[model samples]
Structures are given as C-alpha cells and as structure tokens.
Target: MTSEKKTYNFLIAGVPYKLKTSHDDATVEELVEFVNSRMNQALGVTKNGSYQNAAVLTAMNLAEELILLKRKAHRELEKLEEKALQLSMDLENSKSNKVLNN
Candidate 1:
C-alpha cells in the first residue's frame, strides 16, 4: 500500500494525457477507459467535434452523475439508519414489556 502517485499515460479522443494518481494499474486503466468513452460520446455529439468543448461537457456530465449518485446513496443510508433505529426501539420496548409481565 504505497501512497506515492504513479504516472499513467493514456489517450482520449486522439489526444494523449499523463495522469498521476495513487490507483493501481487496473483501476487506472478502468478510469481511463471511462473518460475516453465519455469523451468519444461527447465528441460524436458535438457539432464541430471540438476536443476542448467535448472534454468540458464530459466532465460536467460525469460530475452531475457523481453528485446524483452521492445524493441517492445518502438517502438510502438515511433510510437504513432510520429503520435500524426503529428496530432497536421496538426491541427495547419488547424487552421491557417482557420484564414487566414476568
């Protein structure tokens, strides 16, 4: 588990880029593929196929997805926590009722 960043060279939309990160080779490759796929989609849909514009749009799209996923995860976690709390309260009440009956 080395914390040092490693360099990864990849091409996106025919442009070369070097990324430095702490991710393993396979993880980095997956990330590169994801970005390249998004860039290609953006480039294909753009009127002029402007690389810069496509990249920016792709970034915005990825960011939007990330935010939405985070929000959905948060909501799900909250619901799970609420259910756990309710279950704990029910369990405590049942125990108290048993003790009183005994």
Candidate 2:
C-alpha cells in the first residue's frame, strides 16, 4: 500500500468505469482484467447471460476464494504457533533435566 491515491479509467465486460484507488496502474489493470474474466465466465455458463447475474456470480466466486485463503492461512499460523510452544517446552525440560543430573 502506498500513500498516493489516484483515479484510473478502465473497461470491464466492455463497460467503461472509473475507480479511485491507492494502487498503481499495473495493479488497476490486473484487477480490471481479472474481473472481466470472471464476469465473462459467469455469463458463459448462464442461459440468459444477464450482466447482473454475472456480476453476482463473480462476486460470490471472489468471496469464496478470499474466505478459503483466509481459513488456510489461519490454520497454518496456528500450526506454527503450536510447534513454537512445543519447542519452548522441550528446551525448558532439557534445562531442568541437566540441572537435576548435576
């Protein structure tokens, strides 16, 4: 994230739109391309191919991806934390065992 916020104009599904974002030109371009791709996919699968329906489907797909990634990252973090705690306990036990032997 950068401190500079700018406005960008791009087309999605052949529709022109303007967006204000803190991201750079490349990021804006990538986002527009990705959205268009998703919307096109949704439209392709539908019989009527309504833009509104396509938009809803695209939004749902993106939300599902976000939630799945978040859950995976959280589970990974928990595993790392658990491993760290186990290592710390083992070190403490080793230190106590050495003291007892002495």
Candidate 3:
C-alpha cells in the first residue's frame, strides 16, 4: 500500500501558496526561511513596529515584488524562445543552401 502525499497551502500576507510533502510531520522550517528572506528583501527593518505587524507588512511587500519579478522573467523567456526559433530557422536555411550548392 502507498500513502498519498499531503499538500498544504499557506499565505504569508495575501498571496496563496501551495506545497506538497510526504506527511504531516514535514517540517515547515524551510518555508519559514523562504518567507523571511522575501520579507526582509521587501521591507528592511528600518522602522520600529510590532514583530507581527512587521511580518505581515513584509509579506505583502514581498508578494508584490515576486509578482513583478515573475512577469519580467516570463517576458524575458518569451524573447529568448523567439530568438532560439529564429536561430534554428537560420541554421536550417544555411544547411539547405549548402546542400543545393554541393
């Protein structure tokens, strides 16, 4: 018999996130680290505030930044794909021309 994997969704601020693990005993320490890193990048601890509020605000900021970065990466990927296609076509054309000349 095989046990089904468990998936959990967690939201730091407003973003919905999903992760799959083998069991309920899966440690969330990694997830916490990821969240903390993003939060720190988004909101540097430059102001005096409660830890909970700061965490929430940081998450919100990080979510927005992540979205923007994802969009930018997608656009860059599309451009690279287009360039690859063009290069492949050019290579094929060159090969065909060489064959005709031979």
Candidate 4:
C-alpha cells in the first residue's frame, strides 16, 4: 500500500528545507539527522571548510558508502543464490537416490 506524500520541514547544518516525500516522519527525521551528521563530519576534517565544500564532501562520502554497500549486498545475494542452487541440486539427487534404492 502506498501512503500519501507528506510535507516535512527539516534543518541540516542550520539550513532549513521543506520536502515532500512518501516516507514517514521518523524516517524523514532520521535522514535529516544523518545528513547533518555527515556534513559536520566533513567540515571537521577539512581545512578551511566552507558549507559548499562540506556539502560536496558529504555527497562524495555518501556516494562512496552507497557504492560499497551495494557491492556488498550484491556479493551476498550471489552467495545466497549459489547456496540455494546447491541445496536444490542436493535435494534432487537425494530424491533420485531414494527412487533407485526402492
């Protein structure tokens, strides 16, 4: 079931934004907090960090993280698929052996 879009007002790095999203309030709040935290983390590490620099750094960091996570998930899915196929083959072999014995 799809929920109606909601208008949420949130602040990140002291800047306010109004967004229309299908996500629930808690999710929106959590996302806002995470972005703020990332921005702060970038600012803290960079020398002479402006908001623009921090924003770009945060975006890059998030992109790298997303790519890494996607790669990990894909590898995990491949392993799961391989295991499922092996299990299916084992079951088929077991059935064949049972019929041969009978």
Task: Evaluate model 2: give its lDDT.
Answer: 0.92
Best by TM-score: 1
Task: Compose the digit string of candidate 1's lDDT tens values, residues 1-102.
Answer: 359899988898888889988889989888888988999999999999899899899999999999999999999999999999999999999999999999
What number of backbone clashes does candidate 1 have, counting pairs of residues 3 or more apart or in separate chains?
0
The TM-score of candidate 4 is 0.92
lDDT of 2 by residue, 1-102 (tens): 687899988888888899989998888888999999998899998779888888899999999999999999999999999999999999999999999999
Residue pairs in clash, model 2: none
For model 1, name the residue pairs that clash.
Answer: none
User: lDDT of all the models against the reference?
Assistant: 0.92, 0.92, 0.71, 0.92
Runs of candidate 2 with Cα error greater than 4 angstroms are none
Per-residue lDDT over 40-97 for candidate 4, one digit per residue giving the tens place of the 0 to 100 score: 8988988897889999999999999999999999999999999999999999999999
For candidate 3, report its TM-score. 0.53
Total clashing pairs for each candidate: 0, 0, 0, 0
Model 1 regions lying over 4 Å from their true place: none
Q: For model 3, which pairs clash?
A: none
Q: In candidate 4, list every pair of residues with a backbone clash.
A: none
What are the RMSD figures for all models against the true structure?
Answer: 1.2, 1.1, 6.4, 1.4
